[model samples]
Target: MLKIGSGAGFSGDRLEPAEVLLEHAELDYLVLECLAERTIALAQKEKFHEPEKGFDPHLEVRVRRLLPLLSNQKTRLITNMGAANPEAAATKIVEIAKELNISCKVAAVTGDDVFQVIETNHLLPNDNPQQVKKENLLSANVYLGAEALLPALETEADIIVTGRAADPSLFLAPQIHHFQWSMHDYEKLGKGTVVGHLLECGAQVSGGYFADPGKKEAADLADIGFPFAEIEEDEVVIKKVEGTGGVINLQTVKEQLLYEVHDPANYFTPDVTADFSKVEVKETGENQVQVTGGKGHERPDKLKVSIGYHAGFIGEGEISYAGANAEARAALAGSILEKRLSDKVPHLRIDYIGMSSLHRTSFGEHTPYEVRVRAAGHSDSEEVAALIGKETEALYTNGPAGGGGARKKITESIGVLSNYLSRDQVHPKLIIRSTDNETI
Candidate 1:
C-alpha cells in the first residue's frame, strides 16, 4: 500500500514541529503544502533581511529532522519548502544528510518564479495598468503542475523540494513516479488526483471538520488525526495514520469531499479530471473509509497560475471603548475619517469593519458597549500622512462613545501586484539535481 500523508502547521511557531507530530503516526510518503499569500510575503520579508533566506525559516528546521526518518527507506518526502530558492533549500538538505552520513539525493525543482520574467516579457496585460508595478512586487510564485515535478521524482531522490507548486501536485507526483503513470493516463491519474485531494489537508480528512451522524457529538478531535491515502489502479482507500487520535467515518469523508472543490463533475487539475460527485465512501472498518467510483477526463495543456505583489501601505488599528453608544461612536469616527480622507485623496479607498460586540454574543449583553474598529487602504505615503493628520480630532469627538484612539496606516508600500498568462511561450524546465547548487 502506498501511504501518502500531509503535514500541517502555520508559518511561525503556531504549529508543533513535524517530528513531534509525526512521532506516533507512520507513513510511506510525506508531503507539505506551504504556500499562502501571507506566507509568501513573510518569506519575502525574511529574504529581504537575510538574502539567503528564501523559504520559510520553519521549513528548514522541519527538513533537518525529516531526513533521518527517511533513511529507513520507509519514509520519503515532497514539500513546497523550497519557497523561492528550491536549489539552495535542496543544498541545505543534502548537507544535513551528509552530516548524518546518510546516502540520499535531494532533487530541487524550480522554474515557477514568474515575477521578473513575466514583466520583462510583457506577459501582464496592458489594459490592467493599475496592476503593473516595478517596486511593489513582493512575491512571485507560479502554479506549477505535475508534469514539471515528474523528472525530479524519477531520480528517486530522498526528497523532492519545490517552490509554489499547485496544491494537488504534492499528492500527484508520487503516483506519477511510482506507477510510472503516463502523461495522458487520465483514468489512473484522476484516481491519483482524488487521492491527493483526499489527503491534502493532513488532519481535515481525518475528521477535524466532520460531524458525526450516529452520536450527537463532535469527533474526539483533540490531538486530531491527519489523512492517509492507500492507492491502487482499480480502487483507492482513505484512512488516517495509525495511532493518531481521529475517526474516519462516512461523514468525515463527505466533509472533505466538499472542501475547496470548485465543481463536482469537472474537478480539474494538471494531472487528471476528478469526478467527485460520482465518488462513494463506505466505512469498511473501524478507521478505514473505502473509496471507489472515481472517474476521469483529459488534463489541461496550460497550467493555472497564482501571483501576488506589494499593494501599497495597507494597515489596521484596533482600540476598545466603553459606553452605551460605543458601537455607534466607532462607526461615526470611521465615517468622519473616511469622508475627510476621501476629500483629501480622491482615489483613496477606505474600508472600516467592527470586530467586537457587533459579532460576538459573549460581550455581556446590554450592560456594556465596546467596538473594535479596523480600517485599511492602499495609497501613497502622502495620503497616509493626510489620514493620520485627522486622528486627534476623531479621538476628541463629542460622539456617543468616550475614550477611544485611532490607529492608521500601520503598513505602507506603493507596489501593486497581479497575475496573468505568460504569453512569452517559455518552456518550464525541470532539473533533477544540480551539483553546483546554483539556481537555473
Candidate 2:
C-alpha cells in the first residue's frame, strides 16, 4: 500500500497540524494543496513589485519547519505553494536546506504562467471578450494536471514545488508515479482522484470544517489532525494520526467527497473527467473510512486558465455605535456617507454589521445593543475611492452620535476571469535544484 498525507489545505492554514503529520504519519508522500483561484493573482501583484518574492508568503516558514523532518524519513514533499514563481520558490528552498546543512534535491515545475501567449481578445468562459485590457492584465496561469508533474517525480527530488497545478493533481501525481499506472487507465485515475479530493483540504475531512457544536460535535477540535490515505489496488482507506483531535466517519467522508463538485457524474479535470456518483464510502474502523467505486472517461482537451487584471481601487471605512437606537444611528451614518460620496465614487456599498450586511435583508426589527456601520466605494481613481472612507470617518464629529472605533483604509482590487486554453498550448517543465548542484 502507498500512504500519502495532506500537509495543508490553503495558503494560510495552520502549521501545527502539518507538523504533526510529518512527525508521526510515516507516510510515503505529503501534499500541500495551496493556491486558491485568486491567490495567484494576488501573488502576481506581489511579484510585480518584487521579482524574488512572488511565492507563498509562508513558504520559507513551512519549508524550514518541514525540511528537517523529511531529512530523516522517506516521505517526499509535494506542494503548489509556488503560487506565481516556482523557480524562485525552489531556489529559496535550496537556500534553506543549505542553511540547515541538509542534503536534498528540489524540483520546480513551471510552464503554468501563460501570460505572454494569452491575447486580449481571447474569449472568456462566459463568452465575453477578455474583461481586462492586455496592459492591465496581471497574470494568466494554466491549471496543469497530474501528468505535468511526472517529470519532477521521476527526478527523485526530495521536494516538488509547482505553480497553479490542479488541487487534486498534486496527490494523484505521486500515485501514478509510484504505482506506474498507465495514463489510459481511467478507472485507477478516477479512484486516485477521489483520494486526492478527500485529503486535499487537510483537516476538512477529519473535522475542522465539519464541526457544528451540537449538530456535528467533533471532539477536541482545537488540535484537529490532518488526513492521510492508504491506497492499494483494490482498497483506499482514509485515516489520521492516533490520539489526535477530530473524527473521520461516513458523514465527514460524504461531505468532503462532494465538496466543490458541481456535477458528480462529470467532474471535469485536466487529468480526467472523473465520475464520483457511484463512489462508496463506509466506516470500517475508528477514524478509518474505506472508499471505492470511482470511474472516469477521457480527459478534457482544453484546460482552464485563470486570468488576473487590475480592477481599480477599493476604499472602506467603519465605525461602531452602542446604546439604545444604535441601529438607527448606524443607518443614518451610512446614509450620510452615501449622499456625500455619491458623485465622487461610482460604486458605493453601505452595510450595517449585525443587521442587513449579509443577507441584504433585515430579520424583523429588534433593537441591538451595538451595531457597526461600514461604507465601501470602488472607483477608477484612487483619489475618488479615498473620498468615501474619508467622508465616513468624518462622521465622528460631523454626522453620527455615539460613534467609536472608526477605521478606514484603501486597497487595490484584482479581478479574475476564467478562460480555456488548448492542452497542447501549455507545456509544463521541471527545473531541478539541489544542495549538491546549482539550478539545472
Model 2 alpha-carbon drift over 4 Å, by segment? 120-126, 362-366
Q: Per-prediction TM-score, please?
A: 0.80, 0.95
Question: Candidate 2, TM-score vs. the true structure?
Answer: 0.95
The most accurate candidate by TM-score is: 2
lDDT of 2 by residue, 1-440 (tens): 89999999998999888888889988899999889878899898898899997999999999999999888877899999999999899989999999999998999999999887786445445654635666777889999999999999999899999999889899999999989999889888888899999999999999878988889978899899999999998899999999899999999999999999999988888899999999999899999999999888888889999888888899999999999889889988988888888888856899988887888878687677899999998887898888877887899899878899889999988888888998778899889999998668
**Colliding pairs, model 1:** 136-415, 312-413, 313-412, 313-413
Q: Estimate every model's Cα lDDT from 0 to 1.
A: 0.65, 0.89
Collision count of model 2:
0
For model 1, residues 314-383, the per-residue Cα lDDT tens digits are 4444444556766666677667656655654445433333443345444554434456555444455545
